[model samples]
Target: MTKLISKTIALLILTSFSMLKSQSVKEILKQNGSFRKDTIFSIKSDSKETYLPVTIIKGKEKGPVFTIVAGIHGYEYPPIIAVQELLKEIEPENIKGSLIIIPIANVESFLKRVPFVNPLDQKNLNTAFPGLSNGTPTDQIAHLITKEIIPNSTIFLDIHGGDASEDLLPFVCYYNRKDTPENTKRAHELSVKLGIQYVVSYPYTLTSTEPAKYAFKEATQQGITALSIEAGKLGTVQKDNVDLIKTAVYNMLENSGNYAVKKSKTVNQKSTVLLNQQDYIRVPENGIFYSELKSGDKVKKNQILGYISDEFGNKKYDIVSQTTGIILYKVGTPPVNKGETLFCIGYNE
Candidate 1:
């Protein structure tokens, strides 16, 4: 009789736990606490009919809140896959902290498979940051992400892939310049926990000054940890890379004490080149250009990088490197325009 009573109590406890687990992410959003959902901004135009969906997954267990944002440029689908796959693996019972995921930060851009170039205002969604309250549609989207999504986050991972016209090698980024002692240490620790092979420290460049920059930098300034990760290309979805990133993100949450998964391999920030000094070589003039060097090739100062010729091939201008470095990325598009970046070169030193 006593044994039967104990078994009944155990079953009751398990049933209660299962009931709690069945609560949807939406139900979690409506709860009162440090966690609540508010639309900090919105974009509604006649031509574009969609809303930028942001979810705040704030765990009531009193731990860190990490935000994962993607699809800022629409076509970057691998990160979206990563976020969705991650959501499936996380159990509310195991999560001690919060995880806010904006799988498609730019919903219209994702639907169109194009970067949100503000149709009416002529602005890129990415370039419009710290977005004003009364700004354009793109600006409002940026404002929404910044105001609603970023404030409560203790850590942020803004995942992206190459924009249109290029494919990227699987890599992760933690801008070295934005790191404080706390953030730098947090980034390094998270890098190890994620277990992605190539751990790079991106320096503050003009490229780093936009899009995720304001949120990442602001998160750091607020003593929060932030890292940006990029993999694959604009429209194409690399399934393997997506799976790898999903695993890494899961491992990170596990390490952060939010999930009960096995720990991942710890990686060193310095093991890879961790290029902090980087620059892009832009096309000097409009021409039919041919690049002799591919991505990841090393070049010396003044080396023959490529050649540009007119339509008839009558005259050609040789493009050479001004510095010795590794080619991190090269534009995949042809018939290049003057002032458009052709190659991203990073110095090891």
Candidate 2:
């Protein structure tokens, strides 16, 4: 009788363990042809877990998996709004592949109205890609994105805009790889399909180091087709800019055969090749920068783009264009620091 009881107890324990495992394996977005929202925890504190919002939509028919991320800088409001609106409009039933949308990647920075870097760790999320698991809060977020989110994606899109202190034009960027010609070609096609005003290609030969540091660069290194879309300006959330970003995303979805929408005509825009660091103009000293040149303005080499003056207007430094190209973005804020970027010039190759 005792032996029989022991066998029954052992069976019950095994059954219980099986049940727990099954419960844990339940997919976050279990229903096909539907959408569900969840939280991806990047940091865990004593009291609560800091997480980013993740929306997963599984299609009825299996195809590719597209990952869309925004709000990396927190102050870029247009991309954040665009992704939020996209989550509402995409229907899983009409999609052919999975769609993962991270509307706001840095919630703490967004809530605090921080600009380029996270206030908690003072780290720029963009530069901390493929990050360390036990690093700072920003690093942990990057690590989660690189490991948990990006690995499941076949295509990746990172949306950005002019931060609180930047004024910029609409542009798209893609990584160019000589070793992976097919991936580079696909990324270029994706950039053109985005239908932005301008497209910039970052060649892999520019740096000899590992290319797994920047968000899009890291995705490209992982064999994922990735593109970065830039829109809006000065950190303001304009409805038109938001609509522009949303339309570009829809274009990609249609072009990729994931969304059952009207096919968008691919419009090829002018391409700007950034070959070196000299493409950017940096400030020489701390002062107040006054620039009349806005983004998209064409300027000649050695042209006076702006001028920096001391607080009392005593000493002044002239900012000039280093290359004969169109201004991609300029500083919107008045204050400047030594070695800070004042403007980025984009030229056709």
- State which candidate has the highest lDDT: 2
Q: After superposition, how far is residue 58 of candidate 2 from its true place, in Å?
A: 0.9
User: Model 1, stretches more than 4 Å misplaced?
Assistant: 1-41, 45-49, 116-122, 204-215, 263-271
lDDT (Cα, 0-100) at 324 in candidate 2 = 87
| Best prediction by TM-score | 2
Summarize candidate 1's per-residue lDDT along 125-234 as a digit string, tens digits. Answer: 66666676566667777776676666767778888776677646666667665436667777867875565656667664434344443546555544567787777664
**Scored by CA lDDT, what does every candidate get?**
0.67, 0.79
In candidate 2, what are the lDDT values of residues 182-274, reduced to their tens digit? 878887777776767677887675344463777878788777888899898998999988988988888888878788767444443545444
**Count of clashing pairs, candidate 1:** 1
TM-score attained by model 2? 0.86
Pairs with backbone N, CA or C atoms under 3 Å apart (clashes), candidate 1: 192-267
